[model samples]
Target: MSMLGTKWKLHGNGKTIRPGHVVAPEERLAWPLTIGIGMQHVVAMFGATFLVPIITGMPPATTLLFSGIGTLLFLVITKGRVPSYLGSSFAFIAPILASQQQFGVPGALGGVVLAGVVLALVGAVVQKFGAEWINRTMPPIVTGAIVALIGLNLAPAAKANFDKAPVTALATLVTIILVSVLFRGILGRLSILAGVVVGYFTAMARGEVDYSKMDAASWIGLPHFQTPEFHLGVVGLFVPVVLVLVAENVGHVKSVAAMTGRNLDDVSGRALMADGVATVLAGFGGGSGTTTYAENIGVMAATKVYSTAAYWVAGIFAILLSFSPKFGELIATVPAGVLGGAATMLYGMIGVLGVKIWVQNKVNFSNPINLTTAAVALIIGIADYTWTIGELKFTGIALGSAAALVVYHGMKGLARWRGTVAEPETETAGLPPAVKSAMNSAAKRSGKKP
Candidate 1:
């Protein structure tokens, strides 16, 4: 079998490819079509990638450069089998910001590096035992709840962005929905990019866009890179984020598996390891922590293109664009409302994906154990509930994830203990003698032996 080429045979007119057919990782379309699809992935990732730097006070260009570098690295580590894009991780935002205030940017970088190391260690454990252990520890109910929690946790940020400019945000959201629902093939797949472009022009027409940044930006420039300074205290502060990263990566892999109809359990460890290494590399270069991007996953879902080659092309394009200050400025000029609108859709889909996982797995919600686990996880994650132990903190997705595991397992163990001694069959014992005799007689008559 070929590792990296078209697996499907063309029939009739080879020029026309059918809709809903996944273009596999090893496959390639004509260069022009492939490049356009790659560009769509870049556009899908742009908002979140730059937003991290804007929030954390890191240079946007550096973040973009590292995002590209990290994605390429991830592709290499996963053997180009996984179709994922590495983007700035919002999971590390709170911890990184807190570390920055306490220690400096270098210190925050140190913390990020440490977090990466922790994730790498976890990846090692995953590789050794395989994903089955993780699945058992975090079953569909728990994983589904945790995944849904990620989306619910980000709802406020999406809303805040929308509130900044409601009109443009609504327009962007509506345009995306219309294009996705009404259009077919590539046009439908490019809905996110189309929405952003439409919303951007709409914002510009309304004089909401600031042109000064773009005008002042030089056509060519290099990203400002910073070196990390290791501090034990700061490093310790960010380690908890590893949990969130693991949960996110696992969910991302599962989602992609469902989309691609491929079994990715074998590559789960490699994917996590890649993400960890990428995060460490990004931290070394003064970039935000990186994670598998759900935004791009949404694009893949819409486009039906799971080609790893497209991600490689997108990464190269991002790297090239990162050297252009003009390009960075142009991306920056995307209105907050437009970004928010896109985020709303992307995040909501991620949440729905968790629901999809539960549905696919046939999680029995009627079981009190399953219901309780999901309930507690959702409430804690959605509420942004937090806990502190000494200098370590657990909150939002991290806390929700931990809670789901502990609650589900604890309830299961308790239930097992309570039922250790199986009760005798009680149906006959509780039935009236006449009815029982009648049932026995009917059984004997039907079977000759009861």
Candidate 2:
């Protein structure tokens, strides 16, 4: 068969491939290939998607159901132009736990709803003014610091779980690292799922697995949905989380744009609005706030398939699986230690990705303005710093993000006031030559001059 007739094509080191030959996001493959690829995405996202609900004591089935619903909603909002999977967000885990403690699950859901509203409002601003204003305000330094803070801020949670079952957690973490580092292609892409499976088996061997729930679970059932109760006090506690979500969504969109060699800045507002609406919908259903999954992005990077159609298939699959109580119970059987191991790796990767962003943007650390911004943001975020006034509280990732924006922009203003010619930001300088060449090629293909 000719290359064009084949269902799959390889773009290895020596192969000469044209940009036009690539499978773009809007294109579709045959059903069999699409289903298989979609399933791979499902596996890629499964570990982290379920982990958030598990951590926050939310119903896994409900979370799974809403994830599908949210992704579908997002696709519709973006007019199916963007390929993404919406999953429960880890950024809200701390806030959810705290809100639940103070105001019960319904009240927590209320706070989540309000946070979504806040995100939507921010999205409106992005839509009206364009993403450039946001870019100017946050920039690489601020966004990177906030991203790193997200990962670092979650370290204690991972440690707490690890402390419960050290051996199992360590085994899980090791297995993930080995798979990710040593394997190639799909296996490496699915490292987190592999780690979870290995860890679960390890836990089983250690007699840590509990089959009681799985055995008792029904074969099929609807998720138990809950109604949110609005509380003014709890809203203040959780509204700040929108800052982290904004930073996260912006980064994810930019990463996807880079990977696809397409400029998606045009839809930045729509993406944020979709995610915000998804979060609101999920909150109404007793699920965590949802965001685009980076795990799926890694899968796309590995497989070289960026089809939006595959995401539709994946969403449908998730929707079907969500009705299976047995599946939810099975996921619950995985020991906490196993989760800890995976979370540790995932969270650390998130932090490193922040640094990667800085490197990719060629953020100048030598500049006192950039240096001070990043320094203060990291410290505030990592330390979970907070300030309270009356019933309002600014803290955690929110505080860190605020600090980053204020510090960076403040420095920029001061510099301009002093009549100093700020250094022009340069393209990535430290990246490998081959990678840079590829980026240039992608830029050219996308009709952007490199």
Per-model TM-score, in order, reads: 0.75, 0.85
Tens-place lDDT per residue, model 2, 204-234, is 9999989998899999998868989987667
Off by over 4 Å in 1: 1-41, 47-58, 89-112, 226-265, 293-310, 420-450
**C-alpha lDDT of residue 196 in model 1:** 79
lDDT for model 1 comes to 0.77
Model 1 worst lDDT window (10 residues):
419-428
Clashing pairs in 1: none
Kindly give the number of clashing pairs for every candidate. 0, 0
- In order, the Cα lDDT scores of the candidates are 0.77, 0.79
Candidate 2 overall lDDT versus native: 0.79
